[model samples]
Target: MKANRFVTVLIVLVFLVGGLFAQGQVERKAVEVKVLAGVTGGKDDTENALFEKEMEKATGLNITWEKPPSGYDQVLMQKLGAGEVYDLLYLNQFQMYALANQGALTDLTSRIAASSVYSENVDPDELAKIQMNGKYYAGFNKLEVFPLVNVNKAITDKVGINLNTLNTLEDYYQMLKKVKNYMENTVGRKPYYPFFTYMPDIWDLQPWFSSAGVRRGVFKDASGKKYAPFVQAQAKPVWEWLAKLYREGLMDPASFTGKTGDMRNKMWQSQEIVMDVDWAAWTGLYNNNAMTAGTYPHTVNVVGLPGTKSPSGTFMLEQGGASLWAIPANAKHPDEAFKIIEYMATKEGGLLLSAGIEGYDYVIQDGKLAFTEVGLAHAKDHGAPFPISTQFDLGVLGTMNPGVLESVAIGKRADVEVAPMGYADGELDARKYYDIMSKWMTDCIMGKMSADAAMRGAENELRINSLID
Candidate 1:
């Protein structure tokens, strides 16, 4: 009787174990998703991986990532035009407007409202950026505009100039002259250029112009007409000032066509440049390599750009949030995509995507977040996996770090202030501005044409494109 009773218990235990295994497998749903994203360095990679991992776990769905090799916007356009459907799409300001105008993207306002996770995580201001015609179409992970000027402390010290004392554009010019003189006399090398302003890209040029009390390119007038600030009378002084920098050899001539990678390498490896304006993401790359090679000088620091007041008696345009994430009209699993977006926006998700898995990747010590040396080394060398939302999407969930805010305060010139350029509307015609402005600005910066001529040409082009009445 005892032997028979023991046999019955063993059989029940075996069945129970099998049932649990089957249940686990059943809960996991197998699905495929294609995502379009712009390629950046570490943060983007880490964020993309984290989003995929978390969403897979929560929804029991397997996601396949299909990222394009070239320009994400162009690739997305081509794919959509070809009738290719993706599970999720990453949209920037231009692309979002273009796609929405073409009816190529889904209305996400309803989906966002329905998701408890999204409702809890998203901020109002952030939500405003993604809205078009009173409907929300995109979500963001962070909501701050971060532009940091990285300076080589060694170069400044070698010239005996105080970095802190340099505030105005004139002060900046004098310091650059000193550095250039030092390079010529002592090092027998080109003293690092004073400013490596990227003229080919309007996004880059906007901030510098913004510092000079001019909000040019994409802005509006009092009558609500779309106006290019660079062409206005107020912009004349600013352009003339930059033209002087070019003529005086304070700024690099090659920056007109230099790619971002070329500029990054020149600053990081060669240390040939004294200062370069870049986003905060570059900081991670700098910290990772600076200590290992001991190439970066200890005195180097990051700060904001100088700002000036406009003649109109207002400050330069105040910048706002960067990029955001949008789901494509053809996304296969919209529901699952929203879940992933929500997770990354939440505190729990932000930590995971930005920092990584807690015990394995980082540890908290003394109420301060500290990475183990090994963890830091790992992040520096191998790079961490982050969710896609955190990288492309801004203002969805995570709060800006104090450092970013401080940089903004520093960059704001006393006379220059930030102003809103108006939120993006779902209009395909808006994208025409990019093609027109980029061409005209490039011509103006290269000295191929006069600023006045370029402005007139741009106006004519806008008229031709129907952007102006």
Candidate 2:
């Protein structure tokens, strides 16, 4: 009887130990995740590689990155429609809205609220961007600053234009005329045209429209009960300005139909365009590298265009929010993925990804962040690699660069002042309005329609869309 009892106890002990071992094995396995990310040239070659390496090192999670062919929205819609499981998904404003409206994305309001990282990192105003009916759906990566007008110093000097005093609309036109004449008479070539305006994209129109105090298509009246359409009123003056420029040959003809990539190539490679509006980050990267390589004629300087109001006023509609890192609703290992996102937002993780390992990638000197030679080369070549979207949870306020902030100087001018309109939600579908206005605006600019007729047509279309209702 004693021997049998002892054998029974031994058997039970073995079973318990085996069960524990099995559980441990399961826990040790890395969480498998598939992520869809939009591919930019720099991202494919550099940032993605570094992100993969760092994420693996920080968390044992293995991630598979996928790029959708063609439109990201179409790919997402198809995948969700087919019930395909994605561990994580990167979404732009349009994609976020479409998915949210379809009930495809999980509501992350509670999760974000519960997270110490999120609560600490996000600001009240920045948090507003992700909210729909007070529920948070998505996060932003980095706040997109207002577009900067980049000028070639050589071209400006050649035309005898004073950079500082060119602060009015009339002054700008005069400068462009001077450059056009100088190129025609002296160089026997266009030294540089006045502006390379990309008309096909709505973002290209933002600066001009905003400068005229036109806040999108909708603005609330004083009573708050009525919302007035700004486009009809504002487009008149703005389109007139554009028409004047077009007639004088100050604006590039290619701008009306060329793709953004084509426009960029013309500006950078041909060096025939003097002024173009682009994101400060992109301009910085291009100018920095081009100058370093000795391929560019002069260092590109960022200057603010003349605004109707204060320099910052022209930028009131500018979107400022955090980009988010989120696990998909169907994620197999949600907890593990969240932990990885958490780590990435930490100071150590940010430094590792942004600056890289200190001794090897960068070093602090005289209390300033200084990049090593390798780091400098990497920055010049790779640009910002880590998904800054994850860093949104860090709650750290970032200062704009001097050049970028300088572009806002016009916003501060005494003659210029920003009149606040309501929030310009990036994700909302203003497609119908955009389509109608774009068609009419193009027609008006091309002299196919009168400004008054275009304005009337736009009002009728807005009413039909129930925007006024």
Candidate 3:
């Protein structure tokens, strides 16, 4: 009888333990989501792997990433055209707008609005943005714009140049010329540094144009008539300014196309570049690197761009959010997709996305956050601390740009706001128009053709494209 009782007790314990195990397993839903343009990490990397392991446990998500190096553009486009199945689609601005217009994207309006988890995780004002044609079709990350002129004070002080007083295109050009002449006369003919924009992409030139009261290739006059940014009278000063930089050898040739960030960074790190157009955060990062290298790097002063009227107002990229994640109209697991997106959009999720696991990737010491040495080094190569929402930055980076907020040196120049781009003057295609103006701008800056010739060519293209009508 005693032996029978012992056996009965053992059997009961086995059932209890198994029941608990089953319950725990039930708590975590096994979600396998194929996500495009998700975070790409090295498969063999210990840190990324660890983070992913923890993230899976926390979010109950196993994400399969799409291809990289070129991203999911081509494959996605092909699949989208073929009407293939996908749960969520990550799109660029053009893609989001175009696809949504074609009814390929599902309207996320009701689901996102009703989601308490989503609402609490992001900013209060963010919901207003993500809307196109008054309907929310996607989710986006928030971004802030603080355009600054990162300059080396050592060079400027030596040249007896004061950047504070400098405004307008002519002022900047002359100052760069002075810096160039002084550098060559004192250091050597090596052209160690001159005036250089950081990335030099067409989009990067937005700062100068914004400062000049022309936002996104259009300027509205007192009558509110919109005119193209490349018009001769309006573009002359902008072109003339850059032309001098290129023609006089003051601006790096790479500035026209903006393909020389590596060379620019090397020069900046060595305290050789005089002026650099960079954001406060990255500027501070480079400055810190220079300091650590014992380069005696000059103090990088932040200034407003030339001809900026409202220097206080910087161009905010995607005032709505960073990248927009949209669900396809024909997605199978729409609810599951939203679950992942909502989780990723939360503060907890954002923290995980940006800083990674605390002990491995970063550490909090005395109420301050710092990246581990490995994390810091890896971050430089991997990319910025990417939170799904731009509002949550890598804590370490937030510390770097304290001075940026304090410096309100941008003059109250005219504020140029770019409304959403549409078919300009009923022109079905504005791409050729952009191409023409871009070619002109390039030609003018490279001195391959004068601004007049460039403008004439642009106008001819505009006419041929039927944009003038």
| lDDT top scorer | 1
Put down candidate 2 lDDT per residue, 1-469, tens digits, no spaces.
9999999999999999999998886666445556665432123435455556666667766765566656866787688678877766666555665566667666777766787875655444556655665676664333334454566556778677887775445666787788788777887774345578776634455556655556554543445332334455655776777767777888887777777776666565556677776654545444544555565546344344543232344433343223454556666766665665555445555555445544445577776566677666555222123333333321221233324345544434455433322333332236666676667766666677777787788677766765543
Candidate 1 per-residue lDDT over residues 38-141, each given as its tens digit? 53212345644654565566556676555565677778778888988776666666667767777777788887788766666665555665677778777664
lDDT of each: 0.58, 0.57, 0.58
All candidates: TM-score:
0.70, 0.71, 0.71
lDDT of 3 by residue, 236-282 (tens): 66766777777778777656555546534644564455665554344
Residue 340 lDDT in model 2?
A: 56
The reply for model 2, stretches above 4 Å from the true place, is 1-34, 39-50, 59-72, 119-123, 143-146, 190-192, 217-230, 292-324, 330-335, 343-433, 462-469
How close to the true structure is residue 172 of candidate 2, measured as C-alpha lDDT? 66
Better of 2 and 3 by lDDT: 3
By lDDT, the candidates rank as 1, 3, 2
| Model 2 CA lDDT for position 116 | 80
**Residue ranges of candidate 1 with Cα displaced over 4 Å:** 1-53, 58-87, 110-123, 141-144, 160-167, 186-192, 220-224, 298-323, 328-336, 357-450, 467-469
lDDT of 1: 0.58
